[model samples]
Target chain A: MSAPHSATSANGVPTLDVARLREDFPILGQQINGRPLVYLDNAATSQKPVAVIDAIARYYREDNSNVHRGVHALSERATAAYEAARETVRGFLNAASSKEIIFTRGTTEAINLVAQAWGRSTLQPGDEVLITHMEHHSNIVPWQMVCEQTGATLRVAPINERGEVIMDEFERLLGERTKLVAVGHVSNALGTINPVARMIELAHAHEALALVDGAQATPHMVVDVQALGADFYALSGHKMFGPTGIGVLYGREALLDAMPPWQGGGDMIKAVSFEGTLYSDLPYKFEAGTPHIAGGVGLGAAVDYLAGVGREAIAAYEAELLAYTEARLQEVDGLRLIGTAENKAAVASFVLEGVHAHDLGTIVDHHGVAIRAGHHCAMPVMEFFGVAATSRASLAFYNTREEIDALVTALQDAQRIFG
Target chain B: MDLRDLYQDIIVDHNRSPRNFRRIDNATRMAQGYNPLCGDKLVIYITLKDGAISDVSFQGEGCAISTASASLMTEVLKGKTEAEAEALFDNMHRLLTEDAHGVDVDELGKLAALEGVRAYPTRVKCATLCWHTLQAALEEVDEPVTTE
Candidate 1:
């Protein structure tokens, strides 16, 4: 059974302590366009807290050295810190060990790694890779590349107009020919939190591995990879309030052992003598270089910050904000909420009949509210919903109800201009 | 929502009662332009009368700025010769992209409805998609079309 809770912590309520969270993030107190900055673009790249920033700065200042080969004190310290970060990530995702976690540039690169490494080796001609229609382009394009290269087929599982995956149809799409089923744990464009655990189970039942793109889900909710039974999972550090150029790709140990190294380079080699070198073990086999040491440390700090704030707290607060936001947004004449999925994160995507999403974003920005506009890198989702684009206001723990009110007021003015 | 600064009264009026939002039967040269970024598409139908643009119409789906821009573009180039139409297209592009071009804003004609597009960096492409398609149709015409 699912956890019997209202997405709240054991305190029976979500305790965000917004004032405390705000203090951790220095960027929150700044002014932009003559108004207090209301950062609603968390899904894109969340603002970093002081701890994560300091972690990155400290690593470069004191622990700046190449890892794995260093015997000196500073290099040893840097290597320890890098590996410690990997351990933190392993713990965060509930993976068996740190060996299963491979660091990459971001979720895009993480997905691409699996596509090139495991996908190339396993997928046969006429094999099918199942993905949802609402997948972000990162999830979609990598699978497309793999299919193109391996002569495999890419099958799209359709979602209902409400943005929920048609479970019956999804189950029907899976078969013996299905080599892999890749799906997003949450829809970045629509904020639909998919039931990936069930989907993963279904894929495994069909004898196919499942890769969950947790770029959107990881930041907003608790992600237990083992609980979800995901064979592979990917997440970006930037979305988790960490530095850019850092992400995690967690694959089953057996799968990682079987898959070839994506890039053959210095560290990935077991014994390089120009004759044919054996590849390194899991995790390092995929890393292949002096990894983003500082970035990984920063990501560890970010994960710590989120844990401190509590994911359940953030999820509950954002859910309340989304509820209020939806009600307020619906009050505006001619305004329509695009995605009404039963399970959604705090994102509110809407279209104001005559006003374009791009125009709405510009007008709202004038009020110091920064929201995302356009396809949001999910072009197929936009095409599915029959909208050119939408103005998306994605929320985080620091976002307040008052900021949502400001968004509503700004959107109301948008109606007057477009009308 | 500073209507006077961005969405002028002219823009709202033109958006409400669009001048030319119909299809042209047997249009000599018809082509469609799409701004995939914003999902704006415009299908331009042009009919030349003795090497001059006699009838021009458009029908497609887009936001207010793009649709009104399309509607206004059809109205602006209806009576003008091919050369005048081409010059107007250039002026519109300059106006949208480099608003500081000193091309008198008065010359914007009905296309002035899209001046709000200048404030919006992203939608500038939506405003220009129709004008670009019109220019494409003009370029296709053989034998230098009559100038104003």
Candidate 2:
């Protein structure tokens, strides 16, 4: 469900007031290259709204203290804010308990946490880790490293030309020896929203655990990890209009309790001594040392802001915008879209016939159109498409169709010069 | 800065039809260059005769800046001795990265058209990657030259 429902909200009003919402993001009002900035690089990292910025600043200004350590008033406030952020993330993902959510550096670290802590402890020499062709390097390399260290084999399922996982191939790759199945909830480079719900069911049927890379998906739609039955779901807050360096890893509570701590430090231990130390419980067992307290506060505000705007409304508006983008891009001469899956987020990756992707990126950038050009940390996808690179224009809910028109004009100007 | 200053007409022409864009069957030396940032790769081939570079060619896929830089490089370094070519690469380096007043333009010739790329700090690597590859070809390095 890209749109999930009709274009109207439950009250029959238009789902998203993008113009009013745009005002909250001050960066969107700026001018670059002597023109209005049409930011289309949300897939890399989104612009923060005033609420998130104020929350972070206010935390540092007033509640600046290490959490879970001090007994004073500021420490209590900091601890309260940090813990509440965890609860916010828990509710955002619809997890059973806040203990299931672990505050990590970002999605990359979250995946690495599972790969090192869970994979190293559970995997055996003959076990296998199954992943797809469309996975970002963060998902692929962590699993690869874990497999090498644990002597577990890594298997990759193939994707179709449309940059989608072939369900049949994916199922065929699963087996009794498959210990884990890692897949991206949405392809960052291609924007193909995968059928992760069905895939999780398939993985469970084979008695294998599943991890969903929800870094790209959480910014666009509501993620119910409980409903999806996902054993692990990793996401980055920066991609979802939160601050950088804060992300969440949602894992089943039982699975987390069984795993050893990935790192050792002050906050993660209950009793440290010359002898063996007793580790903390559940989430804190994994989060070691002094965490980014202010970042957590900011992320909480980001979650609150998105909840205020409504994820369903954001999804619907972006879906319509994506449709408009795809249609307008097709009108460009000698331009070809790379990912054409039936369902996708608001991401469009394409290559101009005469110009290299980097050239297009540089050209459009001069017109104040910011898009991503390169492998997008998905070299495997680039290899599959047989292209050196592709320019990607990823949109958020605040993006307007008029801004999309500006992108088209810049791209056309590039064509004229290169042609 | 203006986009025209970055994508000048001369650089555009060279990119559209690169010169010496071929692989030498048997060459004195060969080295591969890669811009991992952009997934751009190029191979520089050289042949020497009478203590001077007799032929030079390159084959690769990159942006207009990289392709034009490599194409124009081969055209200028055709008959220069090894030392002369090295000096020219140094000059090209200064021209792309240093202040304009610091560049000695005596030997830059038509290659000066690429001076437009100096305005873009990020694309500076695209303009200089070919020279690094050429430097590697003249040396004993076995691995590909990378602009990290």
Candidate No. with top DockQ: 2
Q: Local distance difference test, per candidate?
A: 0.85, 0.93
Q: Which candidate has the highest TM-score of all?
A: 2
Model 1 chain A poorest 10 in a row by lDDT: A1-10
The residue-by-residue lDDT of candidate 2 on B1-148, one tens digit each, is 7778778888889999999999998989899999888988999999988878899999999999999999999999998998999999988988888887867786799888888888888989999999999999988467999875
For candidate 1, write residues A1-419 as lDDT tens digits. Answer: 12221245586886666766777789999887788888898888899999899999999999999998879999899999999999999999999989899999999999999999989888899999999999999999999998999999999999999988999999999999998999999899999999999999999999999999999988889999999999999999999899999999999899898888899887787788867888888778998878888999999998887877777877778888889888888888888888899999978888888777876887788788999988999998888888889999998888888888888888878777766
Q: What's model 2's lDDT at A99?
A: 95
At residue A104, give the lDDT of candidate 1: 97
Residue pairs in collision within model 2 = none
Candidate 2: regions farther than 4 A off? A1-14
- C-alpha lDDT of residue B62 in model 2: 97
The ten-residue window of minimal lDDT in model 2 chain A covers: A1-10
lDDT of 1 at A346: 71
Deviation from native of the Cα of residue B82 in model 2, angstroms: 1.0
